[model samples]
Target chain A: MTHAVSNGLLASDLVKNFGSVSVLKNINFSMNADEAVGIVGPNGAGKTTLLSALAGAFQLDQGSILLNNQDVTEKCASARCNLGVVRTHQIPKPFDGMTVFENVLVAASYGVDADKQTAYQHTLNAIQLSGMEHVANRQAESLGLLDRKRLELARALATQPKILLLDEIAGGLTEAESVQLVDTIKELRRQGIGIIWIEHIVHVLLQVAERLICMDSGEIIADGEPQAVLSNPQVVKAYLGGGIE
Target chain B: MSQWTNSVTIQRWTPSSRYAIVFAGLVLVLLALAPLFASNGLLDRLTALFIYVILAAMWNALAGYGGLISVGQQAFFGLGAYFTIRIADLGLDPFISVALAALIVGVISYPISLVMLRLKGGEFAIGMWVVASILHLMVNLDGLIQGETGISLVSLNHYDSAQRLTIIYLLTLGSMAGLLALLFFVLRSKTGSAIQAIRDNEEAATSVGVKPEKTKQLLFVIAAFGIGVAGALWLTSATTFLPKTYFSVQWSAYMIFMVLVGGIGKFEGAILGAIIFFLVETWFSSTGVWYLVSLGAIAIAFSLFLPKGIWGELERRFNWHFLPVGYQVVEKNKINTDKK
Candidate 1:
């Protein structure tokens, strides 16, 4: 049950461009250990692209990322994961042929180099944490949308990450389910895991995140206390005509 | 302590006992008495069936369990045969030659996987074919195998045809059982889960910290090793290693047909497919190229109509599997403590 405190993450002057189109421009951000931050933006605000860069899923066109006081800008995704950085996808990508238990089992074994018995117990804990124990024996492909999201969370959590990057986990969930997920995230925060949640469900973010940042055109428009950030004039302008009020 | 002990005992037998029993029974029967029926042509055909079983199972492990569809296994098979011939010329026993040849082929295949693993989907499949063609041409150019004339295995000259055939058959059976057992152990391990995860979804697997490229490369090498052993055993029985026969595209085609017809992922499906394939070959061998045509037709039919293959269909219907690779925790004897 012991959790390591991450030395926090720092991204300086981050920039990414796909062909002639600039997706992220001169982005600077930092999140401390035990901090829960929520990222909100429009559909094409490059929220996912930023998450991918932080997770080292792809190389950044320019900028440096430091995790725990070490430069990890050139590290691969697996190397970042081994350094206790993990991220889930906006779209759940559960292994189709694997059962829920097996999916988590792989994470526990390879993510931290735990022995078989310990890995098995960790896998069980992850399944229990995700509230997916009932479907552990079922193939992941057979799961519904909510269960797929749960499986995605379970797989990420089983890696025993110090920093958990959640991308739109509550995006497509029902109101009740989003509330339940918010509770889970709150519990994880209580356990001292740093979480960066990218969510379209503003209410869920409001419930769990102490800090909130709004992005427009891939640049942070507002950053502060959740209430203050949500109420900022620039944030209001970005979500204009989208009914933020 | 009593509760802990009880749970441990239950865990011991819960998941894998039935499969272990079934696999043990099959191996015992095959090893103990299969040679007793050696008088008929049955042993000869069964030997071939065993070789196909190994080949098909190796392919299944690559594509089904590991999600790597390779059409270049014939390259290793041909290398194994040619190496066996070379080893025999150096005065080695045929059995030792098979092992030596397998080793050499395994080493050669490691570098090959690096190049082949870069291609994905249809590109990967065609890349395998291209590798096979290159290897075929290279082996053909080597005059030691007499190009198309084929090389007669010199070491088997002492044994009569039937004796040699029997020994070769036993060797193949033993190799098949060993390889199957190795695969069963691998599939039961955490590595197997990672491989299965990669097969299901590579991006998900990477998210979970499974290195897909490393896993695929290891599986590629292991599969090549198994195919190489099968090749050496095949040449020993035939007492000849013709570059044309050894390096033919037909070897790859036959393996694909076997796995596709029987079942791709299931271990026993490979055995079942191999037996069915050899039986069909026996019946249709007299039809010349029509045999290949018929095989192709059957493969197409299975691909279109029964995409999961024959054993897969049967498994779905009956919920039966001889080699079960995954574990399940069963809740037994749940006590209502509060009611009690």
Candidate 2:
């Protein structure tokens, strides 16, 4: 999270107001290369909003974002993705009519701007890494929940991102399915790609994230070591449903 | 004793349908040579068929792959006719005017698409139709276009009917085949992949670096250009350009009917649909307004009963493919050399 730089992402003074209600309140965030950071927040807490703004899916009322120490605050989502800042939607958004391979291949070629040979290699690597190789030729929409999420991750990874922002990828997954996803996320970390994962599952997040960020009402309430952030009284109060209930 | 081990060569690629082998160069050669001996009436009919095929194919690419449900494409189709007639009236070669009109209409589509594509789904569809009507009225104001009186392409009169019909028919045929090939290659290219990605999921496509606006705009102009040429061909056939008829929403209705019934998203569907539509129209168009009602009825029936359209339904049921651009896996174990 340090500003010293080395292929990391930084967002400063991020602010977004949706019709007078501030969804993101002057947030400053940073993540380093190969780092896995997790964000946990309650409903209406604006966690997804933060990811969207950073991803350029939404423009900030006020903010500047940088990828790999270069300013990309004004770039569209696709341009930001080409610059190695790629994100996955909270919901799986695989291209319905396209096969699973086509989805990843598209991301590999377009998002990361990989050349043809490289795109093919990257696509295969991504499908293999995300464990979607088995259903590579299947139409994306035909897949079930677990496979859809895998396709989503495979799609994102195929883009060859220097930094990846994940939003609610573990939502609606069974505990066992979430573990499989957590393992995939860990494998992504081993590939040296920086990750900013937003998840509702605290235990899964705790297992993978070295750093944890807690947000409530559009503001970061706690940021630090995962264990410490989870135990912080403000963090616990804001999220974690006030413990046992 | 020696024996063949029968070692199978396993590959990772998808299997292409063998049906394309049936559509080999022989068919193209036959089509190219048909007009030489065919009667003028048949040539006239074939020219109309070519134009509709172009319309159906372009509409399929726009609505099917790009998810741009524009029912107002006739605006450009009519514009192509008017522009051709206008250019031809200026004493330019009537045949060359088609290409010029296509380019001009394509450039015009850029600004228009920016405005038109801002609306999505039904609103976009309706917006385009309204735009077409406005264009139709605007074109009517031009005295050179002859307003409601219409204008014959008298420049083509010098060539005589037989020679003129053959040239235009061949050109129309050539243009249709060229554009269809272009559309096919585009869908197989990376841009096509990105375009389909936008169709399937715009937000997701954007997140993964597919430029929705750029891809869509490009497809819009390309489709406009193709449709404009088809319009020009229609003008050549009729030898006159009627703004009211050219700008009629019936063109879009016909395109939607063909694409929907044949296979809205399938490339082969456009061709097959156009062929079926051409035959049906020939048979019943003489029945007056009842023909229009039947077309409408057929389009509705296909949309309701066969949601995937004919080719889509068949592909799901029978795994039939004529233009299989996307990959289709066949397991290695299923590879039987005896069948080959």
Candidate 3:
């Protein structure tokens, strides 16, 4: 096992299995603060599962997760969120009954444990950052696809996370919408929040990702600079079989 | 050059909510002053209405906001009455026993909630009924209760009928008001948001740092406490301690009916539904089985036509919020940049 960084995220020998199938096998990953890393993989490559593990959605069957050198493998999802590890769902899951502002406020209030005034401020700022200020008072269930996706991002942002795990937040959007999401992610990178983004859209990932990791059959096949990893023979064959357009 | 900036303000009250506050104050004043002028019969009916309100509000907070959808709250209600009787037997004033009994129910419900709250959806609903049945059987085993023969709070015979009527009325009214106010403030607080968030989507709520189990447990315990008080208050009025009467599934049915008819999730809807149910029972209860049949029919109709409930429809159409338990973000200014 490599030494855990005191100011970043680290995972070593991570193993997760579902019944007899090993969804994630011996996964070793690490990222520094403010580093923007993108992950691309074929279907069933365990990208989402990896994000879920890091976010503490469920306990790992093996290995460990370290957030800022704090062993967080045993912590629950909410505790990890409070510890500054937050994630957005691949499929947007807003609190349908709550307004956009209220949805974000939940994260600010509980995720960061901000007081009322500070939570309100953070909620407003997150809404503004996600370009959702216009519909801040609108019911979350009433949002269109793009707005819903933005809401997912805004909610995660309100957590004031040290490390953000984004799972295909830009999926199923038009090219223009994708570009807009990329711009927001770029801004987040500028603010020095460590990000591990998983997206199938190779071009969008290249826009904000300085480093890239490619996975095949639940194993990291290539890890390095975005262009280098994308062009790796194993990655091209496993993920981008038709080659990047 | 002039520059514009947007300032966001968080406010809970709108014009409708302000009007609602004034209206609620007026109603409370009238209810408080009722015993002075109201007849014993009128006071008796009003007390029943208060109990119904308590039951509806408690169930609404549990199933509507917390998403527990328990069908066994009667367990606490029955326990409350039984404990009140037991405490009175131990030399405490029965009136004081009511409060003490409800507190005991709250304490015991924590452990119960830990076990029962693990069951979800239909399992939770039926599991609660089973728990109620178990408690009912346990109470039956007590020699003092005398099984189906039942027991009565004979200690209350010391008060004259008029005095008993007035005291019970005041007690029930005061409790109903206090519980409503408590619900209002709780729904407005951050904890209120946590429970509602859990109801919306438990997994999503957890990812945002809201502990679903802990939040649900708190709500469950509170609902049990309030329902227990309602049960004890009901016993005070009836002056009877029939386990069959207090622990019946009918109480849970009534709660479900009121909450569903009024609007399942809306705070005002529960109150409105309780009032409607109370009025319906007062008018049509003489019709025998048809009255219950009609209630079932109304609940089904409401479920089919207005799943959000009557209050939910009204809110959607007229944009009225009698109890604004959520935040509204007001954009103070809009910035416009002309061609540079």
Candidate 4:
């Protein structure tokens, strides 16, 4: 929250291919640290792939990613996370056999390079922020789906990320649970952490995201205000026509 | 809405765990004094059990905690023995050679880990075994080893039989205790958490800033060093090193059986598994092939029924944990009230 000169995340000319199929093509995306952006698309829209590329999950075929105006194309996933870009998996990937508190502790200790006391404090704060204090001592693998999703958010928050990339965090949650998650995400955005959420839940995503981007066939077809992007003809044809009731 | 309380304290050691520590220390001290009263054969058997403990614990830390199921540990075991003999041939005391050989094996494991760690799952297990086989063939080519006729550590003959046996027993015991202590401390630290996180999910760990490669490499090297020391001590006690016997895949099989019988991921399980294995081997050695067949049968039975191993089952049923590898969060007010 105290960052005075963060330029946020910038990705230019990103291209990625898997075998004979192209997943992402010539993508250019940018987001500031003070805004929340939502990405919505049909299946195989390269939305998650874009997030993966930004998070450095795999090598980009051709691209340059800049975090705070510094190129991070060569950095590995952990290195990118240390530089203030963190992500949550679409399906929760909690560290089994560890307590929920310990899952976030790993992020604070390694992501921020915090010492024991600082890391512990950060872990507690992340848990409290994500409303996971009740099950803080429980093993992560024992958690239900909603709590598991919250754990993913708590872990990302513990990293003290400037740009948080969330990949369909509310995919399988009930409507009430989705509302609760939206409240937590709203709180995060208010605290000045940028979030780029990829979701299939449009109305829920619209509650928190000021801006929205839509992609189809590995290319962004719409980028603007949430309503404006949603109403775009190409976006509707490529995504919302088949999705969104 | 009420403000969330953030005054919880993390507790790692319970009263039972604290008492367990004292009990373990007492047991170690009592075991250390065994040679003073126990017969030579018993002392020899105890020494062999200590070596099994060392190997099982190292493999447990590597495969159990690190998610690296390696069967090629005998490579380091054999290399450790060979290095000790080679170092002793230069006129060094065999005791010092044991330590030096272990250190050299640790260094050698770094490069080997670089190549081997790239392989995952079954590939890693089989790849390590292949590497061990290659090392065996290479060791047989050495002039000193003399094409599998092997070589004896003649340097050990300088000491009287009683002195040599006593020293070797002490060395093996010390190494087992030292390695366990090392693992305990490492698993209790931040790096320990990182390693476990990587084990559970490598890509997820990276998103949280855990370096999988570096953490796995450290564990691989540590396992090699400890297994190496065990091999060096074994050669010192036997005073002989046959390339075939030293690099035998049977060593890997022993480690797997012990970890499976005791518990795969628990520290106490490895020690427990090693002891059970030592006893089973002792009682059934006369049964020859039946000994190995029963060993396999027990391993299979444990896999089918007690898959978590004995320690894991006990912990699951009674919620008992003697080691401090995990954290327990308690509210500060609860602690204060409990004391009152």
Q: Local distance difference test, per candidate?
A: 0.82, 0.85, 0.89, 0.90
How many residue pairs clash per model?
0, 0, 0, 0
Q: What is the descending TM-score order? A: 3, 4, 2, 1
Against the native complex, each candidate's DockQ, computed on alpha carbons, is: 0.48, 0.49, 0.57, 0.57
**Please, what are the lDDT tens digits per residue for candidate 4 over residues B224-266?**
9999999999999888899999999999999999999999989
Tell me chain A's TM-score in each of the predictions.
Answer: 0.95, 0.94, 0.97, 0.95
Q: Write model 2 residue lDDT over B144-221, tens digit each, in one string.
A: 876888888889888987888889989998999899989988887899989889999999999998988889999999
Candidate 1 chain A: worst-modelled 10 consecutive residues by lDDT: A1-10
Task: Tell me the spans in candidate 1 whose CA falls farther than 4 Å from its real position.
Answer: A1-6, A241-245, B1-23, B26-33, B332-340
lDDT of 4 at A4: 29
In model 3, where do residues sit more than 4 Å from their true spots? A1-3, B1-5, B333-340
Model 2 per-residue lDDT tens digits across residues A49-87: 999988899788998988777888999999988888889
- Which CAPRI quality tier does the interface of model 4 achieve? medium
Best by lDDT: 4
Residue pairs that clash (backbone atoms under 3 angstroms), model 3 = none
What range of 10 consecutive residues in model 4 chain B has the weakest lDDT sum? B331-340
